[model samples]
Target: MMGTKLQVAVIGGGAAGLCAARHLLSRGDRFAPPVVYEVSDSVGGTWIYTDSVGTDRHGLPVHSSMYRNLRTNLPKEVMAFPGFPFGPHLPSFIHHSDVRRYLEEYAQHYGIGEHIKLFTEYPLPISSSSTRSRSRTLKEEDQKSYHPEEVAIKSFTYIIIRNRHYSDPYIPNVPGMEYFQGQVMHSHEYRTPESFTGKRVVLLGAGPSGIDIALELSQVAQEVILSHSRPPIASPLPGNVIQAPGVDRLSEASVLFQDGTERRADAFILCTGYNYSFPFLAEEVGLKVEGGVVSPLYKYVVHTRFTSLCFIGLCKAVCPFPHFNCQVLFSLAVLDGSCPLPPERELNAATAEELRARLESGFPARHFHKLDSLQWDYNNELAQLGRFEPLSPILKELYENCKAIRGRDLINYKSYNYKISSGSSREWSLLCPQ
Candidate 1:
């Protein structure tokens, strides 16, 4: 086993999965080229917008949650992968289709497309409910599930799994929902604003999707009501939009708010975001999905209890491409025995301690994987451990500035262009979008 090239199984062909495969292919001596299992017929997982929602042609739940008019909220400068620029000509906030093309190009350029097995279903977790407390021993059946009839059963020490983190959109069940129902749907089902024309819409979340969807609906809807538990947004909403307190309940032909206010609406759109569901991985692996967070993962990549398994691209509110790059390289270093992890007991303790601290700080368990502003620190930690160059400081500065721009003007933020020059000075600028 030590003499032969290490075999790795990458579960998805999304951005994170592509990063893992690209890095593995680059290091042919230490690792074998990864076998990437993509459920879709192509790369670029969530970036690919499918007009078909609910279930796809294969009867699998539709993986993409992207809307028609969606452009990246983050600028291209921070979103580009390290060592691969998006080039100087493209606008900072490009459309999602452009992102899919860029990923396809990235795969083609690196010869990763040849190794990718598209239109394959993810293998069910080897461990079933019977083995509730212990990791499942991978048998010949598991290996066959990975490559189907093509690749033979081979002994591989490491398995790299990618979790896209954007499946199973969530909509909280409000009481009395059955009483007043016009059209109830989640943002994942949303394709265009045309269906909502001239209607009174109630959006039940103020996250990025809610804000973006409300803005899109404002153009076509007669009136849009944004109901949320949080305090009002700092930025002013459009004139046609109304901010309401959290929903208390609903009645026939009316909606009740916590403030005792009532409004009647034609449709209900839940932008409440998604849940963390890894249907492929069983519970015996010492991982738990309570609320929206997957737990007991050291560094949010490796399974602390099962060292051979690692998950990529699970963190939320991150600079995804660059974040995936760092996570992938660090994971490879761990697999190659270049970067040593802590003992199993220490790993479990560290994971628990991190969650304890976060909970003590008043953050919900659902946000355990949200990196948000803390992603810069997480990236540096990985780079230092993996012995790779850390991301430039300018990226963090520019990222924060982008958040500020969004807060100041959600509608006009995408209109600005951004650039981050290379070298020590690392000049950053924001110009008008072309």
Candidate 2:
């Protein structure tokens, strides 16, 4: 027996939300068309560049993390979603503007703009007992709760999007930090280097943002120190940049390192990363996060306790478009009753087992949500279970190869172009500068 059409609600009209709407619409009669809610006045979420950083005219915190000079680290070939190729004339590596234009074109080509409600925000779920109650809490002239007509379209509905985290950037606690007289700010507050052109800057953390910011600031800052707990960076750094051990404490005007070294800097930037947050989800949902990771998500998409509540594009360090494609299709299949899922207890056990293995393998608690090397296998499993085409093998091979090159030549890797040519079903070649 066929179930009633599901009315899916997609949150945050970014890459993931856009893909979800496209797939749900393509499913035709099986599902009611998806309604996308976007807080911003446009379809692109983080891709929409805004000069405003702290807050907008409406006092909402800015969500875009893109810097003015930022360009994609990955090639256009792999970045593009399946069946939607980037312009052939464009270079393999492109600027952020190009990506924004591409997303706009995608929305227009698929007629997704009409289905999206720009500037409309949905309230977080209340609770399982009153998930359907029509209660009015927050009032807004433009924003609103789901309408009866929309909810009545289907007996089941689901929404999927990546979690928002930039509203509150994480900062590590260090003794005497309160006495620091110099400027202290999170990387989320940093948009450009114009203000710090002649100042010495200390950046915490050595993740991608820290490395990229160090390089960016080296061009302007008098001195840039990348302080991190990890081993020294492998790539050559700019002349103005230096590496230092993790910070031990901060004195009024300087920082003391664990190695008994101290340096006074004009400013400190906490590139320590962000915390997982869902402002709209109710407290009783039990979607708790510990050590920067969300828990009890079966296959990292469906909630083990409530399978109807799913999350897509939650994994880190992946080919986002292809990954979203697999996840959305798999989730929709499950909702449509085509894919048989195990009991809730079994699903919860599976998630626990995976988390245990990852921790036992020496991965830190912070890396619980990271799917860097394991993403390919995970995507394949979703595709197999949902009976959809898995990501091309070339995608995995090229992604791994590019990561190595980036680490070795961080300064010049983006200068080269790449092309993927497939000769047979499984045979492919990645063409790049030798």
Candidate 3:
């Protein structure tokens, strides 16, 4: 606050944004009070938007939206912030509502809530010609002509946001979807189950949401049809939960499959996920999306050429909140001159194509930008930034012992299992009556 501090903007007020902001403050480096722009009136991005108390479009109530008695997938020990451990009475897996509350608590504990600018949307700004040029050279007269405002603007940078909540649902073109549907709606519009009580329902896709709805309506609806292009993996756990083999495909829904084997239904709930897109940035920004996958950028951290601007929570197959927060802190350290940026190369056409091929190879042709396991990813990121040394043998043994205990299931709540040994305090309950 004393000198001219660098200006930074953080987009989105979800867990990722809060984590980034907290790290920025922790660094206590010379920087302007970082501005956090949240487009919603409240903080919780996806938690608030999701159907927490009502029915879904398929007439499945709020209770059906979530897995029956589901708990947090991650244990409390790893899920919580660095200093704030989950206290006693920790459940193996907490409820979604409890998770939302914990997010709010994290924001409050770190004093980040006060810094956030709610109800603000960020539309990407046009890049000025002077700012884009690669040449750093300036003429004698040009140097004298520079104004204070121009210099400050040049130094300022931004952090872009991408998440499931931002994406608009993708509903593919089916031949007679318009003709025979009694009631049709995308998952975005779905709210409750009162409407489908006695009606036959056909829920499309076999992802977590689709499976949840199918199981909820099976008993109430005359018949519940789960239509999928490929059979789900269906991993059977202690409870009657089935983990889908992989992500679902939207294009697989063809007229033939619908007519040949699919059951007729009173309504169709398309649980198909969203597409990879950013409405704000222009195509020339060099953020490439090939075959539904964004081009690989520097160990999935900072953009190769654009060091000032960073992205968080873009990786798939990992929990974005805590993992991304840890990654963002490392990135911030580099940006603040506390650490050095990792060595990386500019993405070329071939690299982009390779990423595209890798994304398509997954079970369902969807682009969530998959990565490896959480712990390994976190460790690699820390190493890339040169932030942490290898754990000592004693510490490593202790950590492994903790992970083993956390992995055990103590309570079988259907899709929600509580890993008692995980010692997660953030995992709480969101109990909805049947």
Candidate 4:
């Protein structure tokens, strides 16, 4: 009983969850096999593409925002988890199906798929008596499949929420939305660009998804107005696509641009991004999402009050799989007493100080978790704290270079091929100039 393995319940069998499970299995002496609860039948989280939108057959909202012809923006070299590289035969940037298959392969290679509890709901309210948390309602009768004893716990049960924030799409609020009602939709509902053929579409937000969707629609749409608050993208857009300032508001038949221009749009698609929703987290958890920032999370992984409660894949503008790996290791270290966390007050103060520093540096409160270039150091700190190997230096170099390439030509950036040399060379290169 003294050496009993810790029970870990991973909510969401996405890449992050799988990483958590893999590490948990790696340290069999410390951790029991993680029970990964995934709402979908598969393990690929948002990468699992579906043509269906709005709801699934079970009447649940569709979580995948993948559209047809979508490909990974990050090259497989950087996208892959450490020690597990994407196939050499595969291109640098690959199709969504390839990415899905990569995740499946990662799960299988680590025997993580066997530990996954598919279609299982998670994070029901934590029982006051025991540290064990009861799972909420399951969809249909899939609850019958999982053995409750597997998720049983005594002390704190580690909850690794590999939750995909992309599920909750966020459309910017503009005044007078009730007046001009075209086929207003979020990027989540976009499956194929064929329906927009011969239509005037005004897409909101200039993020990667917005620009990508606009480019796709240009293949069919007669006119595409890409609206955004960010500086005008210098890259050449398709003939049918044009750039405009952010939308001021909507009239009965037109949208007014911030620069005093107006356009009658047949469809308005919001690529504004999404809200981080953890519906499974009970109210007592004390975690809060305010203005797009999830708080009480020290260093973005460990919950200050609930030390065993950890989050993965929450930071944006990052190389996801490796980031998840670092976070998972750090979480396990905290739980296993390898990386002892600070006291509650110190933890909260650290979180507050980090936020305050970022805010003072001109980062918007809503974009506090947008790590971008800061992810390299964040990952390194996690590795240093958790006693795990940090990511290769070349990965960050490649990542930054790719961002520049994407900015130079978003339309053709995916055409490039890259290769990271094997072992401690810590070097990478562009394979071919496309």
Clash count per candidate: 0, 1, 19, 0
Local distance difference test, each candidate: 0.82, 0.78, 0.53, 0.84
Report the C-alpha lDDT of model 1 over 278-305, residue by residue, as the tens digit.
Answer: 7777656667788776867889998777
Query: For model 3, how does the per-residue alpha-carbon lDDT over 1-434 read when each residue is reduced to its tens digit?
Result: 64656566676677777777877777665666666766545576555535433443323222122333335545454466555555546553566667667778888988898888654444344232113211121222333332211111232454535343334567777656756637777655665666778876667777546655665665467666667766543433223222222212222232225334434457767888656555555455576655555544554556666666667766654544546655676676667777765454434443455455665766333443554343454445555574644222222233344334433422223323233232433222323223
After superposition, candidate 3 runs with Cα above 4 Å error: 1-4, 50-78, 85-90, 123-155, 160-166, 232-259, 337-368, 372-375, 386-434
Candidate with the larger lDDT of 1 and 3: 1
Considering TM-score, which of the candidate structures 2 and 3 is the better prediction for this target? 2
- RMSD per prediction, one decimal? 4.6, 3.6, 10.2, 2.9
Model 4 Cα shift for residue 146 (angstroms): 16
Predicted candidate 2 versus true structure: per-residue lDDT over 243-330, tens digit per residue:
9999898888888888999998889988888887777777777888888778778898987776777788777788878888889989
TM-scores for the candidates:
0.92, 0.91, 0.70, 0.94
Better of 2 and 4 by lDDT: 4
Ranking by TM-score: 4, 1, 2, 3
Q: How good is model 4 by TM-score?
A: 0.94
